[model samples]
Target: MSFIASIGQGAINLYHRIRWVVSISTAIVQLAFHPSSWTKPVRAVLTRQIVFTGYDAIGFVAVVALLTGISVVVQAQVWMGRLGQSELLGPLLVTVIVREVGPLLVNFIVIGRSATAMAAELAGMKVRHEVEVLDSQGLDPLVFLVMPRAISMALSVFGLAMLFVVFSFGSGYLCGAFLGTGPGDPGIFARSVVRGVSSYDFYNILAKTLIPGLLTGVIAANEGLSVEGVATDIPQAVTRTVVRATLAVLVVSVIVSVLTYI
Candidate 1:
């Protein structure tokens, strides 16, 4: 009886979370497409979000990507040579660096940096009744606040993923040249990369990056907005946002990887 009761309670909790996710996701979509949501004040909010989430993330993302690239180049040279497939260095780099590592790392960074911050900020507003104050003032908080942050966050993550790809792959190329991977021939490196990464790979990586960004932003916004009562709720919301964002990204990445093959 005890086990059965526990199972039922777990399902009930899951159902509530699913409902919240669906409701907030629909709200974000509606506001994202609604032109009325983009007034002057909202635009200012959006611009600030872009600056904070996107521009601020660039330096760290670049450094991480560069380091990854350098490591990949060294490994690719050794492994490919041992396999007697040294000519496949570019393709190996493309697959490991661009397809998997780049998107995953950028998404992780954004979740840690921006998602937690957004959750705490929104929770703070809620705890202070500022969101309710906006309600009384005849402004929809969704339009005034949440949706812009969601959209900006998604864009920021996507932009950062691109930066990751460039710096990581570019650094890998430089590493290869320095180590004479192609015996000082850049053409070999270029051809391998081009041949290795197909149009399908391009589309798949984009989907992986874009979808996760949108989901992370929406989930973080939802968690923050759901906070109710007390000073302690803010920290709790922030922690939940981080955990949920990490799990959501992992699930979405797995689904994309499977769907691409199908």
Candidate 2:
């Protein structure tokens, strides 16, 4: 009977989590359609979120992209050399780096940085009864809080994903100059990479990046706003935010990839 009760509670908890995610997603869309969701204070917050999630994160994203690009390109060159498939290098880079790695890596960085912070901040506000205070003031917390974040994070992720892919392409080209056959013809390599990517591929990448970014804010907002009880609950919310957002993004990435690739 005790075990049965625990199972029932677990099922209820799962239902609530799913419901929270849906609520925040719906709130984001509704808030976007509202006029007051873009007031001066909220605009300022959105700008700050972009600065933190997009601009400030560029250094780490670039470094990771560079390393990944260099390593993957170098290794591809070596294997292709042995297999006599060196010409495929450009397509390989485009498919792997531009389409897949760029979007996933940028979102992962944002998940680690902004998602955790968002969860904790919201949780902190909740514990302090700030949300209730806002409610009493006739403020719709969803509009005042969640919408800007969703817009900023979505735009930021898309921007950062582009930056990451550009850096990855640059790094791959640089590595190709020394490691591959192209010693002094960077333009040729660039053209090759370009030819490898199709229009559908570009749209697919954008879809993947945009969805993850939007969902990330939603998941973080859900986790953060759902926090209850003591200060200890904040850490758990933060953890859930990171774990859930990352998993959600990865799942979305895979689904997008399958559809795009097919």
Which of the numbered candidates is closest to the native, going by highest TM-score? 1
What TM-score does candidate 2 reach? 0.90
Each prediction's total of clashing residue pairs, residues at least 3 apart in sequence or on different chains, is 0, 0
Residue 135 error, candidate 1, Å: 1.9
The parts of candidate 1 lying over 4 Å away from their true place are 181-183
lDDT of 2: 0.83
lDDT of 2 by residue, 81-124 (tens): 67887678778877888788889988998999898998899889
Local lDDT at 249 for model 2: 93
The positional error of residue 90 in candidate 1, measured at the CA in angstroms, is 3.3
lDDT, residue 142, model 2: 83
List model 1 lDDT by residue over 167-259, tens digit each. 877787788678766335567666877788877788767777777777788778778888887888888888989998888788888887787
**Which ten-residue region of model 2 has the weakest summed lDDT?**
175-184
Predicted structure 1: lDDT:
0.82
